[model samples]
Target: MTLYPRPDVALICGVDEVGRGPLIGAVVTAAVILDPTQPIAGLTDSKKLSEKRRVELAEQIKQQALCWALGRAEPHEIDQLNILHATMLAMRRAVAALRIRPEWVLVDGNRTTDFGIPASAVVKGDLLVPEISAASILAKVARDSEMQALHLAHPQFGFDSHKGYPTAAHLAAIAEHGVLVQHRRSFKPVRQVLEQGGL
Candidate 1:
């Protein structure tokens, strides 16, 4: 068996996910490899940046990164596999979708996914690693856009405002309007509502 070499040159990719806490929609992940020659400034955790800055940085990352890809696991999948496993699945998919194979992946958070490619998990890596920050921005922008689109389909949930998070507004909406097909039934809040026979 030919063993993969340790990450060097263009072989290391950064990975991150967004929408893990949302009660609806998919857990979206991104994998990005930045070109050493073209460095992006102001890279940081996606949550720290304003929506405007994240959008701008996301576009810049997409245009300048050596290669990047996104992956996601739908609510049904999250319910079936659990959030942690579904997140791993999405991360693996993102890595696999890369046009060029990476020797290793650096992922944000404390647990690493079994993506075939070797991976190391770093706490707060999204803030410290430029590539990971880029990935975070990409994932956040993609998932936020998805939430906006979802709002168009089901305005009752206020997806565009809360992004399906278990905010008071969303909970109240669910209590008033009942659950949607996109809601994660496995989540405690949604499960409680379902057990109570819905709205």
Candidate 2:
């Protein structure tokens, strides 16, 4: 078994983003300041966890964290600013919302615009850092919950089934039912719908 490394900083906050590739909904980011005094087990990348496990870990992180916060950039913002900048904005907002300021931030990616505090971008950091993993779990579960709620508004697209990813089912629904307001019109499928006069 390989051991994930924890940040060496005294008060480190983990940052991560979700929904960057979704064809709909907001890009959500989460920042978690873990209590080094009380470390949680089973912390790893959110992608490595089952949905049930992610939900469980999200709850555990919330309950056991020193401070945590979530932020998001809406579809319109993503379209206006581009996904990369929008994602970074979401991360910045998440860190800003934290009740306790972190001395250092460990972000799970190759790039970050700014973190307010000293920060380092860890390539595939989510899999290697407990705090980053906690952030990933929070971001994934929150975005999933949002997509599930959107499912209630547009059951025809089966948002619950695909969680806003561009699945064959979702594409078929768009082709058949036309694009809904929740769908990102700037995305490839939605753009195709418009170009093909499906809208």
RMSD of each: 4.5, 1.6
TM-score result, candidate 1: 0.94
Off by over 4 Å in 2: 1-8
lDDT of 2: 0.88
Per-model clash counts, in order, read: 0, 0
Q: Estimate candidate 2's RMSD in Å.
A: 1.6
**Backbone clashes (count) for model 2:** 0
Give a tens-digit lDDT track for model 2, residues 1-199: 2534654668888899999887889999999999978889999989889999989888989999999999999888988888899999999999999999999888888887677588888888888888888999999999999989989988888999898889899889889989777667778888899799986
- What lDDT score goes with residue 51 in model 2? 93
Instruction: Assess candidate 1 and give its lDDT.
Output: 0.90
Q: Which residue window of length 10 is worst by lDDT in model 1? A: 1-10
Candidate 1 lDDT over residue span 1-199, tens digit each? 1212335655789999998998999999999998878988888999999999999999999999999999999999999999999999999999999998988899999999788877888788887778788999999999999999999999878898899899999999988888899999999999999999994
Per-candidate local distance difference test: 0.90, 0.88
